[model samples]
Target: MRKIAYSLAMVLLLAACNSESTDKSTAEVQTKQEVVHMEEALLGKWRGMIEIPQSPLEIILNLKELSGSISVPAQGISDFAFESIKYNESDVAITINLGGSLIKIAGKLKNETIEGTFTQNGQSYTITLKAYTETPVTYEKLLIPVAGGELKAALEMPDKGTGELVIIHAGSGPTNKDGNTIGAGSNNSLKMIAENLAEKGIASIRFDKRGIGDNTALIKKEENLTFDLYVEDVKAIVDYAKKDDRFNEIHLLGHSEGALIMTVAAQQNDVASLISIAGIGRPADEVLMEQLSASLPPNLLVESEKALQQLKAGKKVETVSGQLQSLFRPSVQPYMISWLKYDPQHEISNVNVPIIILQGKKDIQVTEKDAENLYAANNHATVHYFDKMNHVLKDVEGDRDQNLASYYNPDLPLTNGLIEEITKFIKQ
Candidate 1:
């Protein structure tokens, strides 16, 4: 069934985020209902489009619901699905239980037309799905420039309505547009979140990092890049969003390292709002040290301690040998150095814009303590602390190991509460 595959996709997406503390029982506890398949229930083939107001990039969703399966053509990496389809005659509404994610479609259903927002992953999308009579629609990728480099981004917006723009900055690795992962990496986790955000009335812009994808123009060579390069790319995206009339405001939603980028960009630009998802609250150096120390075995931790000493002493870590080399390579060394340079608490404190900080209690990367640190730094910012979310902003059972495993899956959708917090903040 398409629902089964889509469920698998979500499984992969969150697979990597799973670690020793991920818990799946909670998600499985969702209520179940049985319904008879009704031909008049508005089931079958449905057609819809994801529109971006500023650009011509539109994603076509040609979904087919048959028996118990749902197949999506653009299922590139994240296979979206509905576990069960239910219709209510009183309100002319439909409820689609997409895996653990739920979306309620409500609007006038007449002349073979249905319109409403699909609620998923915390955000709401303005959707209009029509019964398909022709071949499924094809999707085309949209390319845009960020930090003077070309980035592949997808957009979804209403034809003429000026909506809010949510620009999703990629996480710490080389990720693509669909959120499907590459290279020791997972699928486009951020992209999956962005697309789900599009289903909710918000337009999202997600792209490959500078040194990755078509963005190579901005990234001279991977070996020579630094943290500031990412900050500049965020600025470029913000600038582009500002010039586009399609959005009334720009929402900078950064995850993990991207959150640091957003913190930097907010200082330099005029952004409508800020959403720091699973971002570090302490200084990068401190967080790195914490993460390394927490994840590494005892022996490796001892060696890492020596490297940290070298770094703190202002000594080049290159002088270190053995396992230290991998920890302090030329490429990663500069980034670590540059990363250690900024104090997130200090930087976020300087941001005058409204900020919403979300952290997953089960996250192995940016822990709930990190979110608290950020919130503490800015006492006035809105903070939503969720106990069930992982670093990728997906709900997880508290088994840390299983949660990290979800990170590699590349099939799961982000946590449901992520977009909801963002939307609630924006609306406020």
Candidate 2:
């Protein structure tokens, strides 16, 4: 579904007080001395938590002499640099620009902790930080070489090895290896899946796609991207796993758009099994039209349909309305054209390996009909539907608002029976 635009206009608006250019040389020297003293006292690693209701997110700030970076493990963000850091005698203000949204942290240094207010999009939350130390590594960070550049990935190995490895692929639209996207905050769905799988003695690998997160160097231009390129990337990952001696079996698991990608890749690569979670069964254009029809105005919906038609026919629409540009942008049209040609059912039907389809009834983005269509195309595939699960693989018992809110909550565990079913399917 076309929700928020993935491409962000990252404009860092620094609120630091600038010294007047006309200041005397003596004033400049004094300012420089003040800054050096501030850096000496504040430059170090600090750990804290943003007290988000029901989900307190842990954050780590590493301040160097001149620059600083923040890491949110729950969000799978590591060492993301701060746009600006301003400090005085007892107070510090750090600003980070994310997808055009400004996250400003204002903190006062207390006796042993930095007490702060974290504000983002008009919402403020209390935060506190103390000095931090390095911890033991639980997972291994990896970089798999592809054609253009290396793909950033993490490999999680269980304490007890099962000799089985599952390659996890994230969904569409700037989603990182952790299943979190820009502007959507973090749910850690894919990251949770990998951790849970590891607990069951399964190894897993999750990677950032070509142009997302750490792999941004892989894409020279967005217009050059294609659906087939994603499939090829999966095959490349599979090849990497095949060469490693740690695993006896390799399985591919894809969520949302990744489901369709893995489906096509499974046919070309030598994988043991395939898993699809909340994957679309129809052509992507049909699904896009259905999703937009509900949210867009009648005029915009008509234009969206026309654009989809052109893309489906292997043609590009040069003209797109301002409102629809995020979805049908000129640079992204080639990718849409490549994606629109694949029918999930048709792609799944071509897979020779064992297949399992996971669907959730409460999923607002994908319907049960999509799963049924995939099953109809390949009756041999095992299908499981969870009554309470939503699209992010989280359980929801309330109305639409609660279901949508789960998208931003990383503390929520995976829906009951989700990991169990996947584990069972893989062991079989």
- Candidates in order have lDDT scores of 0.60, 0.80
TM-score of 1: 0.63
Model 2 lDDT per residue over 265-381, tens place = 999998899999999999998898898988999999988898899899999999987777777878898999899989898989998899999999999999999999998898669
Q: Highest TM-score: which candidate?
A: 2
Which tens-of-lDDT digit does each residue in 1-428 have in candidate 1?
12332233343234212312332231232323333433364654565532212111112232333322222222221223334344444123444444334555454455677666544454444656567554232223566565554665556553333388877776775555445333333544676666556667677777767654444345443356778877877777777677777777888888888888888888888888778888888776566677787577888777777776666555656665554454575556666666667788898998889898888778877778788889988865878878877775567784778887777666666777676777778767
What lDDT would candidate 1 get against the real structure?
0.60
Error (Å) of candidate 2 at residue 89 is 5.6
Query: Residue 192 lDDT in model 2?
Result: 94
Error of 2 at 302 (Å): 1.0
The model with the greatest lDDT is: 2
The segments of candidate 1 whose C-alpha lies over 4 angstroms from its true place after superposition are: 1-149, 158-162, 177-181, 185-188, 294-303, 309-315
